[model samples]
Structure formats: C-alpha cells, structure tokens
Target: MMTSKNLLELFTQTRSDSEKICQPLQTEDYVVQPIVDVSPPKWHLGHTTWFFEEFLLAPNFPGYQRFHEQYAYVFNSYYESIGKRVVRTDRGNLSRPSVQEVYEYRKHVTKLMQELISKHWNKDWNPVLEIGIHHEKQHQELLLTDIKYILGNNPLQPIYGAVSNEVLIENSEREFIEIKDGIYHIGHNSESFCYDNELPRHRVFLEPYAISSTLVTNGEWLEFMDDGGYSNTLLWHTEGWDWVKKNDIISPMYWFKNENGIWSQYLLSGSQAIDPKAAVTHISYYEAFAYAQWKGLRLPTEFEWEVAQSKINHGNRWEWTESAYLPYPNYQKPDGALGEYNGKFMVNQKVLRGSSIATPANHARLTYRNFFHAPLRWQFTSLRLAKSL
Candidate 1:
C-alpha cells in the first residue's frame, strides 16, 4: 500500500514539476492557436491548479480558500454538474488572470494542499489523494503536448523548452507483427490506483490479429500525402473530409518545408529535420483511418487495442483505434465527485489505448484509456496498423 507521507511528498514533488514545465514559456508563447486542439499555456497551468482545487481542496480541505472566485467559473472544465465554467473555446481570452497571477494561484493551492496532507491523521488519506496526484500528472503531460502544438502553429515557430526533438531516432520504418489473441483480464488490477474507467475488471475476447511493429512513421505519412490521401474523397469518411475542409488541411499539422523542400517539423527541441523514422506527429483519426484504408488494413478496435498493447512496452503514444469513447458494460460511476472523473467524458470522443510520450510512465497500463475529439491530432498521438486475421 502507498504510504501517506510518501504519497504527500510525491504529490508535492509532482505538483512542483508542473511549475517546472511552465518555467520555460514566455507570456506571449502562452496563448497561440495554430489549431483548436491546443490550449493556451497559461490555461493549462491554471486548469491543472484548478483540478487540485476542485477535486482535492473543495472536497478535502474544510477551510480551503478560493484563489480567485472566477477560476471556478474559468477552470471548471467539462464538469457540467459542477456548474458553468468559462466556455470551452474562450479559455484563451482570460488575459486578466495574467501568468504571474496563475502561478500565485498555484502557490496558494499548493500551500493549502500541503497543509491538508500534514493533517491526514486518518485512513481516509489513502487512494483519493493518490488519485488526485496522478490525475494532476495527466494534466502535466497535456500541458507539455498542448504547448508543443501551440508553438508548432506559430508562423514565428516559437520555442517552448530547451529540450530538443533530436532524441536518438528509434528505427523509423516499422514492420508488422502478428498477435494471437485470447481471453485477457483487462483493466486495473487494483494493485495501484487507476482511473475509474479502467475498473470493474472486465473480460474481453480478441481474435487473432497483427499490429505494426512500430508506430507509422513520417516517411510513410508523407507517402500518403504524395498519394493524395488528403485530397481524395473516396479515402476519407464524410465527417473526416468535413473536418479536413473545415481546417483547410492539405498536409498533416506542424509539417512545413522551406523553399529547399526539406521537411522540417517543429519539435520540443525547436524545429528540426523531420525524421523519416520518427512516428508521424499530427495525423487525425480521420487521416489515420484514411491512411489505414489506403493500405487495405483497419484500425484496431479498443478491445484489440488493449490486446495488442498487452503485448509490449508500457507507455508511448496513446495508440489511436477505431473505437469511439463509450461506457463499458456495468460501467457505473463511483459514488460522489469521482463519478465525474471519466464517466462524463464518454461522449463525442474516441478511445486511445496505451500512454503517450507526455504521459508519466509508472501510472499507465493496458487498461488505461485516453480520449479526444475525433479531429484532435495535437496530443502526442499515433496509430497502430491492424488487420483482421
């Protein structure tokens, strides 16, 4: 079992690291829209703070101080039952909160959180706090990915962190590997804390299938573009094309070539040569589906997504699948606010299995689910090619 003091230190340390991620951003770099999928850097910071405020402070801290009353309305995110939050699309307009104020807001929340943990003289101080800490870690990853997308969009191509995208190239071209499927216990085993959506430990049946040995690479995606994957109507679904047209997408996001036609991608390390071997960065489910269709293969379903990942490394990109995000059978929400954690997110989203580069490694599992609106390719996302056997 996770000890209380250790959990407290871990929570504080993780929360502090969230601030570390923001230390590299200049105020203007905080808010830029290359695409709708990214949030402002400031918004990401405050929202994570607000998460701690709402879930942990509101419920746990009896004397919790309101950092700024507007943040409740400003940062309440997707929790309809919680009341009206700042409108989803308008979070970028919160110039009043100023970057410094948001940092102070974070400080106020952290001071109280640490004080609360010091008072945890009872058994109630167990998994709920652990859950809150990991939950914040998810936001930490999102902050990094969202900022990368936001920076990638700027015509100026702003840099967010000193980190370079030049991590040693894993082999760029991936080979296909077959997976013989069978019954598997899929979901959190309750050995450590997990999100509610990964619960009720269900049995799933998977047919024999094959998954790509590596994520689809930039070289292959460029082939799709060269093959007219985007312009071809027959390759895209109705909604996918509508999304393509709405965004005026000719190529995958964040891809640009200089007059020299050398493919360079905006990466965490700033713009770098597009690695033919690197996993293609910004293709949507629609785009991924079109590419898969073009290849005469299908995207894996969630069950198959889980089955295939049950075969490999722990965290990488949240592997995209053909499955829509939905409630599982017997998927009852846990009592109280924890119910709102994932249950409310089932609508209008797609299920992504596995973890992404931004996700914390220790916290991910085969059962862990990631979801995003269909057109969202900004998250550290990629697809695993699958075929029916």
Candidate 2:
C-alpha cells in the first residue's frame, strides 16, 4: 500500500545506509575475508547492487543495459537459476573490480532504480521493490558484523567506528513467566513487507512452559566457564562435543584473556573488559543448548518464543530456539528466481528468534524467522532459558 514516492525514498535511504556502514573501513579492509563464513565488505556492496539489477532492472526497465558483463558471475550469490557465479570462498580474491569501481556500479544501478520507481512506477512493482529494500537492509546488518569479524581478527585490532557492543541491561530481576498450554497462531499476519519464510501464518499447539524474563548475562556465562562448562562432555551434544575438541573451543567468539588472566572482548570501538551486566552474544546454537543444559533448562521452541514474546524483553540478541527451520503449513514459494531465496536452505538449520544489536532499524519483526547452522557463531546470537511445566 506504499506510494511510489515513499518506496523511492525508502530505497534511497536503504542504499545510503549500506555505504555509510563501510565509511570507516580503509581500502585494504574492504577485500579481506578472514573466514569462509564472512564475506568481504566489497563483495557485500556489489552483491546487493546485483540483486536489484538482476531481479528488477534487467527484466523490467526499458533498454536497461548491464554495467559490466562479468559482474553477474562475480556478484551472483547462491542463485543457481542465475547461471555460474564466483565461488563463495573466493569472493575476497576478486580484487580486479576495485572498491571505487564497485561504488560506481552501485551508483549506476541505483540511478536507474530511482528512475524506474519515479518515472515508470507500477503498483505491481511495490512487492519486489520492498523486497529489494529489505534485502539491502539485511546486508546492512551483515556489513557491520562481517566488518567486525574482519577487524577483530586482525593482528593490530583496528577500530571500525563508534559502534557499541554493550547490551541494554534491563533493571528487573530475572524470573520465569509461565504460559498455559494452548494453540497459538504464528507467522506474519500484517500487510507490511516480510520475507517469504514468514508467510502463510499457521497455528501451533504449545505445552505449558515458563520462559526467562531476561537474557543470560556475561557474568552468568562466566560462571559456566569457571565451572568447566566448555570441558564437560555431558553438557554438550555428541556432535557439539566433537566440535569443541576439534576446534579447542574455550569461550565465545572475540573473547580473550589478558596475560594477567583477565577477560576482555574486542568490540567495534576497541578492545575492552567484558561488561558482566551486558547480555552474552556471539554464541552458536550448540553452545546455547549446552549452556541451557548446564542450568537444567532448555531453549524455548519457536512457537513458545512467539506466543510469549509479548511478556519477554527481546531484541538484544538473536535468541536461539529449539526449532528447526521449516516451511509453514501450505507454504508455497514464489515462482521463479525469487523462490530460491528461502526454500532451498530449509535443511540442517536451527531457527533464531528476536533481533540483535547489529540488526537494522525497523527490520526485525516478531514473526521473522532467522536461521543458521548449529556450529556457526559469527552473528550476534544468544539464548534465554525455558522449562516445561
């Protein structure tokens, strides 16, 4: 129901915000991919631009010519229907395009998009444009988190900007809020924009349970570590135990102890002592499950999280849920290349509820379903404990 002019404004703002996130990085910082999980900043810039061009302008715009022929293969990410693309691990190796050139490509695509929205506006075009806007917003969060990973892993530990790593500490004492057994309707029900994964709202029956009123804090996580939480095999799943021994895992990502045996974490602002009052972050589902097991509790199922969300204060971190990423009942993927977005990756992934500090403004919704593999810890993820009655 958004006007063309409003959509245009939103599109412009989303594009500008992405560039702003990279302003603090130097030329050298744009190309390094320290891990396979993290994409280079330069690649994020180009891939998002390619998304708009490939899906919108190329097919619909009048006589819209590509900025570069090879750019498609260079920037197309995981779209099998879009022909060959650069391998995921080799994104950082693509130094030919240069940062300046990538910016130029963005400018080219953005200008045409503006014209498309303003001059030849169509009411039917709103859905795809909205998706493009939100898709870029998604990349905006990844931009910050990936940049943090790039700089945090550097030997010099360079500062990116004035971003905060502290969680907004709630004043209330922690307690569990009980929910009675009942059927709850879940998924996006409003007319506003949402990803395809959140569509086709469905009903779920949840058992009586109690969920924590607050997230687990750094102090609590420290207690787990001091009590040998990492070394205890009984606290972890079999595969999680193998991952711990294989990687020599000790603490959450970006955490390190000084020579004096003091714990500190690297933030975008700089390295600082860990704030015990802040919520714990940068943990994987395996670690979250292990921590809950240590405390004789379990993670809430996605249904429970959604139904009890009104009572809990979330959005500080992406809370891990005891649910797998799967389609809703009668869920049908959108036709064509757009279908490739969420339907293809429904296997072997855990669902994460809530948003995080790095999540873009207005992007998180109560029905939004974020998912990642069990061992991946690069994002700002944490957990809240739950128990069955």
Candidate 3:
C-alpha cells in the first residue's frame, strides 16, 4: 500500500534519475536525432511526464487541466483509441519546445501528480504508481540505447557516459545444464506489478533439453567469426540473411576492426577488447538463432526458457526464445490506461526472457517477459544455446 508521501518521493526520485542521465548532453545533442529511432532528449523527458499525467492525474484529479492540450496529441504513443497522436516519425522535429521548457513541463506535471497522489491516497493506486515508475525506468534505458545509436553515427564520436565498464569475472566457462521435461506453469504470479502478457500462468510441454549455463561470450562468438558464420547461409533463416545483408552486418552492432585486424567492441565508457567472459551483446534473434544453428542448437520456446530459468540466476544476459510475443492463458488486463501496458503488445514481437547487464537488479524474474522485434539489435541482448537431447 502507498502512502501519499512514499508515492511522491518515488515520483521525484525517478524523475531525477532521468534528468541525471540527460545532464551529459549538450543542448544541441538533445535534438540530434534526425530520425524517429532517436527521440530528442527533450521528448523523452516530457513524454514520461505525459504518462503520469495521462494515467494518474486526469483520471483522479477533479480540477486537473492539461499542461498543454497540444502535448497530449504530441506525446500519445501508439494509443490509437486515445485519439490523434503526434506522428511518430516527426518527434525529433519539435526542436522549438527547447530542452529547458521540457524540464519546466516535467516540474509542472510532477506538481500536479503529487497533489493527485495525496488526494486519492489509496493502496490500490500503489500498484499503479509502482508500474509507472518502472515504466519510466525502462524508458531510461531506451533513452540511453537510442542516444548511443544516434551518437555512434556522429562523426565526432562523442562520449555520453564517462564511467568505465571495466571488470574482471571469476567465471569464464559456458557450462550447459540439462532439465528433465514436465508440465510447468509460466508468467507473473503476484510478484509485483507486471505487464499483461506475463499474466494468467499456463502449462507447457517439453522434452529433456539442455541450456547453456551462461550466456555465449564474446570469445565463443569470435570462433563463429573464424568459421565464416556470416558467410554461411545454411546457418541463417531467410529473413535473417536478408536483414544481415541489408545492414552489411558482419559483427555485432558495436564492433569494429583496426587496420591490423584486431577486433574490439565499444563499452559505455569507451571501446575495449572483446572479453571472453562477457556476454555477446547487441544481437538480434536472427543472430542468436543463426549462431545456435551453426552449432547444431536452437533457441528455446518461451516456456522451456522460463522453466529453465527457475533453476538459474537470471543474470548475465537476456535469452532469446523462439516464441512470438503473445498473451498467456486466462490473462485479464488491468482496468483503464494501465491496461495499455502489455496486453496491446501481444502481436509482432518476440519474447526474450532472462535479463541483461543493463536490466536493473531485482527486476528480473523467471516469468518476466522482455521483447523486441526479431531483426532489431539495438539492445544489450544475447542468448543461450538450447538443445534437445
């Protein structure tokens, strides 16, 4: 249950986290995305503010007035039933609002949300507040990923995060563990706030199968490179092959080669030699699938992945599954706009269970569903090998 004070503190802190990340950017960099894939920093800040206002404020506050009626249209993301929204492709074009104005707007919305939280003051709304905070957290990550994608394209090669990602790991081996098949239930089980797709647990069938004890590391993937993994069409799905060729991709998104043929990958702080112990990241399902096929393996279905996860530390990397993103059995969405959280995304996305380094600690769970389009590789994503024994 949420006391008004606790909910207000959370809202303030989460909003502060977003602002802290934006502190590194120059005002010009905030508006650098010439394409839709990179939302202006200003937009990311205000859009999250818009979420709280739309979902929590207007519904509960008797005298609520929209900060800007134009903002409601400019920021509504894919909620067609909510009426006309700003065109997705043109979001980066709204440079007129200025980054400072967005922060002011954030302050305005935060003030209203604090007032509403106090007035309504119920435990029921606590779940709503919790989910909204995490939703903003998810956006915090996307904001970084998208900004990196945009900056990586710049000729300047600007650095966004100053902290080094240097590390030493005690475990470097990729051990494989086998699980005996049985009926199992998967999805959220009153653990906390969850998306609709992770609801109403269901059963699944499986054979005796083995999954890699750890994520496939940069060392192992390098061997695939040595074996011409990219050239071998037999290792790829038809769609995957096309995507690879179209992008001219020969390695993960962050990889580059020197004139001397030394391979390296960019970390948050700067570029570094690919570590054998670190997970192979920035990979799409196509890449994970093709790599598995090359090694006479396969990606597990969501249930098989979930069942295996119950026994392991949901750490290191998010494992891609063969399952398309969909709703679970007997799933009932939460009422109102919160219902928009997950149930609406059941189609066209692939499920990636487990967690990645970028995922916040304590948020990962066996039933947690992470998803993306099959060909997209802009995330800290990788997979484990699953094989039928």
lDDT of 2 by residue, 1-389 (tens): 78999899989999999999999989999999988989999999999999999988998899999999999999999999989999999998998799999999999999999999999878897888888888898999889999999999998999887875445566779999999998889999998889999989989888899999999999999999999999999999999999999999999999999767899988888888888888888998999999999999999999999999999998878999999999999999999888998999999999999988888886899999999999998889999999999
Point out where model 3 deviates above 4 Å: 1-5, 162-172, 334-336
lDDT of 3 by residue, 1-389 (tens): 45669668877788888888788888887876656666777788888888888877877777888888888887777767677887878887887677888888899988777777766666667777788787887778777777777776675667777642322242645667898987777777774656667778777778899887667778889999889998899999899999888988799877887556788766567666777776788889989998999888898888887787755555556678999988777888777666777888889889988766556533456677888889887777877788888
The C-alpha stretches of model 2 lying farther than 4 A from their native spots are: none
RMSD of each: 2.4, 1.0, 2.3
What is the alpha-carbon RMSD of candidate 3 to the true structure? Answer: 2.3
Ranking by lDDT: 2, 3, 1
Residue by residue across 1-389, what tens digits does model 1's lDDT show? 77778877887888888888878877787765444556777887787788778877877787666888888888777777777887767877777687889889988988888887788434575767777788778878878888877667667877766753323244444656687778876677767777778777788778898877667778888898888888999998899999988879877667788768887777777777777777776667888899898999989888876766645442556778898888776888877766788887889888888776677646676688888887887776777788877
Model 2: clashing residue pairs? none
* TM-score, cand. 1: 0.91
Question: How many times do residue backbones clash in model 1?
Answer: 4
C-alpha displacement of 66 in model 3, angstroms? Answer: 1.8
Winning model by TM-score: 2
Cα-based lDDT at residue 338, candidate 2: 84
| Alpha carbon lDDT at 35, candidate 1 | 48
Best lDDT goes to which candidate?
A: 2
Q: List ranges where model 1 is wrong by over 4 Å.
A: 31-36, 58-62, 162-168, 172-175
lDDT of every predicted structure (CA atoms): 0.76, 0.92, 0.77
